[model samples]
Target: MTLSPAVDAWAEEEPGAATDRSGWPGGIPSRVVRPRAVIEVQQLLAEAYRTRTPVIPRGAGSGLAAGAVGVEGAILLDLSALDRILELDADEQLARVEPGVITADLDAAASAHGLMYAPDPGSVGISTIGGNIATNAGGLRGAKYGVTRDHVLALDVVLADGSLVRVGRDTIKGVTGYDLVSLFTGSEGTLGVVVGATVRLIPRPARTATAAAYFADIATAARAVTAITRSGVRPAVLEILDGRTLAAIDDLEGTALRERGDALVVIQTDGYGAEEELEVLTSAIAALATDVQTATDAAASDALLFARRRALPALEALGRVLIEDIAVPRKRLAEAVDGISDIAQEEGVDIFVFGHAGDGNLHPIIVTERGAADDPVPDAAASAAERIFALALELGGTITAEHGVGRLKKEWALRELGPEVHALQWRLKEAFDSRGILNPGSSL
Candidate 1:
């Protein structure tokens, strides 16, 4: 491959850059280029566009959806070198950053100014801000703080044809034209490469109260969640884990969580009225839970939150895991949990349930016997996933809550989106990249 002198950047042909955290086996790309400047990105995109070559934009590559998996004969654009917090205006309560800025780094920086970046996905520590925007990523705080899209104020994107266009305003509120900021936010790099972003931040909470409740089963824990939500106390974080998940965590961490109960509900209330909110939440949860434990200090609070964070890793220790994300109406959360349990039993597969129960976004992970990393996912697990997706739709929810439909879920996404909407989305992509480049074969 040849490049113009104006676009001075090193290209790596190594196979390591061709893969991401997604188990999808991506073909070796022609080259992986890390551009240090916006002009270099534009130049590279322009050259790729002229040659009609596929260009895949990538950040920290922590995505679960294989959205950044490299394709054969493609140019993998690694944007990690562009990590720079260009501006942090405490008065304006916003920060402007390059695409490679780590999400946690930004949050820490904001915290110094008594503010916080609220879109904390599970991969926040390692995931980049640009990647978060790509999926509109959500975390435990989503029920209260919203997702990446809620914080993003503007984006500087480089179109497939190499045009640099800035969409959205820096101010808090604006509706001058079409909401392109939102349109491109969750487009999953299919529309364009996000070179930079301006994201809003809010004042950090003064205090937080954390608590954990144990229930006889997941369904009961889910009911407690519903009760808490209806009790008029909005928690900063609300998460749930099933019996299998709790046992796995206990085995891995040497904790006796399973002995206490078959299910766990972790809640955190924040801001000035955090204690008062906790009083209400504890009262509601205690009515349904067999046991309740409240944190007495910051360390204890983190210890309680650790269980939710370790749920996936704990399950991974048991065997190969196929994690699924889905969301249903909050009122029907218990129904969804029961339906998942039924699916697992019918399929004769081990499906561990956990997720942001407050918002109905559940992660029903299917575990199979240990196998090679490259081995295909079991057919039974795939069938169970389809059934779960159907269940979510049947309950007036979505096939996906936060994770974008990368190559892994594109077919199911098309079914959920319907043919007419899918056609319009394709046309929209054409309007942005007529050559059909830019993260081809992924995210619609």
Candidate 2:
């Protein structure tokens, strides 16, 4: 298992080498390899290919799904050491960066030029660009600017056999060939490892407005979301939090949010007409909301957004959490939330619902009593999660919105994709990696 000199190796005993943020323990790998350059990655992969050894690609291990989990007798390829911003072209409105560059770092770098990298997942501060691309990660601004796939202009990928090839063009518009750039963007490392990427950036919004609307329940808040969506205001961030989530946050942060209402909608509008958009957003939801509060300054705006961002952490503070991501059609968003409440009651578990309401992506987090760090998910929680997935599919939505299927949602993903499309996907996987050495059995 000798790797290139440019690659750093760690024995299986090294802490945190075999798992990811999913809190699932992937079997200990034979070793962990951190490659500093593309050639190093290529060399390591070539050897792994020749030996038919499994290789799992990982960024910062911030993935919620088990996408980056290591396998027994496999090689864990860590790309964090390759962190670098290769180029930032303001005139072209694009930036070329190594896969390991943190998502927030790129946005910060772009901000200096009055531009921003739009795909800001919740883990932006810790997650890498490569990982975001792998999952097609979405975030608060997803309703407006879209996700990782929308921002990615091109990619430098190391194929399963250790060949380096580029996909996509640097230009904004291209239809010369198959959309391989997209194919690889959300492939979850089953196809290839992203070594470097050229991503598109957008100008930073000149103005911004924020507002918080409280409602009696999440379903009601969801109805308000539908109204805002239909109003044609196009808010930059539209998020919702349920009663349980509000209570949890209040308990953890000593905030009186739960006292105000059982559910909340936090909205932020940006760009030159941000103030005008905010007015439309508030007006659309005013009648339905128990109370509506708008921010008058930047500090007040961040204060409103902070609670929405803290939803996950507050839930985590209560106990072990199984965070699930599902998206339904915007019109059915309220139905989806109501169905989830029903599922929670039937399963006798506490499920806190929240997410990017503007785009119909919901995070229904199932919380259980705290136990061992590696404890298996309880049967009730698992059953509740399965039903949630079924509901998402029943409502013409997906089992996963931003989180890649990885190892967690494979069964449901199969049900969602159906046999014919699943077979076609397998054929595509076979075409890319015949030996099945690249993150095998982790995604697709």
Candidate 3:
């Protein structure tokens, strides 16, 4: 394939050298294209499609799945420069934003208008809105407001042929065509590149409260999470951190929690003047907790909630982390947590478990020392992750609840979806990208 001079010239203008390597597992792309405008993105995609060259759409590169990893000969389409808030319709509670806007930046901007974009991925500070849309990311707030797909009202996508198509509607009601917006939300760049999005926002809650509870065993905490759901109390966020995870965080952040408890649950409730509502919910959660402590104010509550957000980074400090995202029926959370512990024991690997307990989504992080990628432990960790994923399937859960099936989980995705559904997904991919040059080997 001949590289167009225009493409080469555009690559030269990128901020960093095209071949700059990342500490991430896969190496960087041979060329990086940072388009300053949507039209430039279209031109880049057109060139790549014409030449049948691989192109990986990257946001902040904060993704754990290595979905942003570039192929050896691929072009890295860095969309971070397209950061712009095109519009904010306060009356409609929706905001139109460029793909490269940081997740936290959107949230902050929304908050200024007394509204919020609910999905709060851990890397919100650095992860781009486009990445969240690509993966249909979920977070602590997902229990209350749902994931990225739930809030997305519309999307402006650039297809494989460099043609732009708008999907979904800004209005609340519309059934004009297939739910392409939802379909592309979690396509992980295989279907198309998201250039901009109109996302729904909710009014900022007037009051908030949080409670921390300790359990003697992880299963006991898992049961409490089930109880909270059964009680019909929707928390803003419900998180669980096992002893190992707490210890890891303590070691990294100098905040001790493992010593005080074997398992921890952090629950928060927020809404319009939700103090009373939160207190009621806390009372119900306290009934299922061993040592329950409720925070009187938002400041204290945020401090407690910070532990969940810091869990992954804390584990990363210990060594390499193979983070797994598994979700099961909310009622079967205990079984899922127990299954993880069983896998850890059988594999004899150090694993830290934590995540959004409210949605039954658990992140079991397998940690091995840096530079130990070839060690037996890393292999054991991978085996453990596979076991945990299989267990989630057996329990009628999903292999990936939030994180997309990047190259790392592609093989397992076949197992999770079965042959029929998998083939159908491929057909859909072909329909959208006939030449199959878009983020090949990712998702379906």
Worst 10 residues of 3 by lDDT: 15-24
TM-score of 3: 0.93
Clash list (residue pairs), candidate 1: none
Q: By TM-score, highest first, what's the ranking?
A: 2, 1, 3
Candidate lDDT values, in order: 0.89, 0.91, 0.83
Pairs of residues clashing in candidate 3? none
> Can you write out model 3's per-residue Cα lDDT over 1-444, one digit (the tens) per residue?
333344343444554332211223454466877777888888888888888988888888777676777666678888888999999989999999999999999999999999988899878898899999988899888888899999998999999999999999999888998999999999999999999999998898877888889888899898888778877678888999998888888999898788768999998888764567667666766766668777757789878887887888898898877788889998898898888888989999988889898888988888877873333435787788889989999999988888878877888899998999999999999999999988876677
lDDT of 1 at 189: 93
Which candidate should be chosen as best, given lDDT against the real structure? 2
Off by over 4 Å in 1: 1-13
Per-candidate Cα RMSD to the true structure, in Å, reads 1.9, 1.2, 3.0
Error of model 3, residue 143, in angstroms = 0.4
Best by TM-score: 2
Q: Which should have the higher TM-score, number 2 or number 3?
A: 2
